[model samples]
Target: MPIISVTVGVALLLVLMMVFKLNAFVSLLIVGLFVGVLEGMSPLEAMESVEKGLGGTLGHLTIIIIFGAILGKLMTDSGGAQRIATTLIHSFGEKRVQSAAVITAAIVGIALFFETGVVVLIPLVFTIATAARVPVLYIGMPVIAALITMHGFVPPHPGPTAVASVFGANIGLTMILGIIIAIPAFILGGPVYTKFFKKESLEIEIPKGLFNPKEFKEEELPKFGISLFTALLPVILIALQTIVQIVAPESPIAPVTNFIGDANVALLISVLVAIFTFGLNLGKKMPEIMQSLSEAVSGIALILLIIAAGGAFKQVLIDSHIDKYISDIMAGSTLSPLILTWLIAAILRIAVGSATVAGMTAAGIAAPLVAATGASPELMVLAAGAGSVTFSHVNDAGFWIYKEYFNLTIGQTIKTWSVMVTIISIVGLAGVLILDMFI
Candidate 1:
């Protein structure tokens, strides 16, 4: 009965968002209350479930998202992103501009959120497309593929990091494994997928105001190395902690490593460094830099709420004993926990169209399997994350973002963007299974 209620609840969510065009945050909260009632909770009890879910999820995510946002905003505002793109493009040259764009995308994707990455980089992508005398999709596809893969699989990108928290996966280990898995997936989704598309399909007129051909003067941009460092600092710090804990668990320096290497602390330090490297040192005023931080925080208000709502929705399932219903079925099945988690997330992604919501809800249902089956939580995070990007269609904002920006038809978006995401999803699961054999 609980499972049946949850199934109807998901269907209702799709109707609220798709048919009635409700906001995702509001829809999720409504669905949370609906599911709770269906599972036999009192109104007060259901409201409490939603509150605990919202508070628990936001408590972990807010600081990390804030610092990450500031770091990314600074990188974009001070020309650090430009510096990396231009230098990489030049290094690889016009002949390999696609390679350069995708590389820049992968690196920048590590810092910026998916939507932010798209808006910030699309102009640069168009500029690169023009200078290189190529179709926008030639470079755009690979760039988008890289960014999407990172957003789906990598930490500090909200989707992956949020899911990682739900699964209690180590952020550091998740990032390491995420990057390892994301590379080949991106290659397939990016470079390989581009080759398979028809030339006519890839061609597009630049959207009027999205193209900015004026380059930032070389003197205006930050140095490539510093730009790279500031963007990657959080990763470096967290990863070093993970490594040190493993290699030298008893090392006196482990204490120091743990302190500085925490995901929050690391990002905080990176933000401070970026304020200097990407802000004041670039000749921008302190107030201007602070203003950028304010803007960064403001931009993510809706996204943060959506994630919090997802958390609430997940909490409702757990409180209602519905997670046990699903977990019981999963435990008795012949399926691997990893694959099953992916499948649940993939289905939710298709129905709901938000990776964070899909991954969070899937984790809630599958997390017990991690302990029951002894599968690695890190791999489950990756599996759920990978599945979260399974199919991007009309429901997915990313699909429309791709379709409109590159002027592709709905059919073309399916042939390209949707198919490419599926490719990434499969490759990601394969990579996770392979890693499981070793780790």
Candidate 2:
């Protein structure tokens, strides 16, 4: 069965990486091919799927990460990152650093794509952790948890927005409800969960080349307002798009918002803005700015490859028709439509490695159940949204991104990134169930 093969494939992948220590990119490639052939594809067809997956994923991710990395690199070298870090540390103090990270992520993540938020905000994680004398995971995990929670549960994010549309849920109401549900979920999953970790979770090396966490003295740092603006420009631009789409969908300026608010375009604009704000305005030369861009691209070359390979593995599983198999099996279930949709989306999330893909696919199965089971369409949307990010593991690009950016091994990622997402998932479900009891 495809499910059995997929399970075996994931186990073998961990064995290859954790036991034998193969390069992650190569390890993913090997397993993608292995799983494809095991599921009955010929070797040549599997190779083509892998190539297509790599191309498709890179096509979208490359420019975004390139700009994001450059933005991060400029902030890192110019002490913009330090300024933000210092402000955060001073405002929140060392003990509450993770709280600061969570709040920052929540604000930016409301509009920014999760990947964009990660690249932009993750640099500050290094700075904060270093300045506060804490582990990178301590600050970083909560940041991602908040971002991922919003990505999975809230509207304007592709996954939940698309799922809401399919369910005919009121987008505005769904968003309000989502935010209400998200608070406790991220609080427990992010800050509280990190606090319960063993002392060793407190130790992590900042990833080399990706960021510099220099603790610059106050005089050397740029003004805090400009640094914060530089980091938040993308959020503002993207949020404008969503606002226009909802408030004035047919406005003449909608076309303009759509253009600039595209993630790639927004990041590019942010980079140019950063060039001036963090670079030229600071009296740095063009060559120095260009040099920072070069270093940023170089730092992520390996990270990009690992992300593509993850996409490849996901493509191979997708090609094997595992989602169809699972859907067919669950079609006759009589569970609560909310819980059933959540289960299907959660399983598909583990199977497909993309929350949007998982949520949309689950929508196809649960769309009819809205009428059949008498569940509220809004709650059903929230429930499916919850499940779409459950148990991120080897098949997920997000899992690899977290692993690479935070410089954690598979074991550490499972313990931190993986577990944190699961916590958010469960909280979302329970919260939805509680809300369902009333309305």
Model 2 regions more than 4 Å off: 88-183, 190-215, 334-425, 428-439
lDDT of 2: 0.78
lDDT winner among the candidates? 1
Candidate 2 per-residue C-alpha lDDT over 126-237 given as tens digits, one digit per residue, 9 for 90 to 100? 8778887888788888889999998888765656755665577765567768888999999999988988987577578777788543556666677989988887776667
- Candidate 2 vs. true structure, TM-score: 0.63
Q: Candidate 1: which stretches are off by over 4 Å? A: 212-215
Worst 10-residue stretch by lDDT in candidate 1?
A: 207-216
Model 1, 1-439: lDDT tens digits are 7779988988898899878989989999999999999999998999999999999999999988888888998998888988898889999989999999999999999999888888788998888989988888889989999999999999898888888887789999999999999999999988998998787778888777655543677788899999999999998999999999989989999999998998999999999999999988888899899999999999988889988998898899989988778767766778899998999899989987888878877887787787677889999999999999999889889999988878778998998899999999999999999999998
Task: Give the lDDT of residue 233 in candidate 1.
Answer: 93
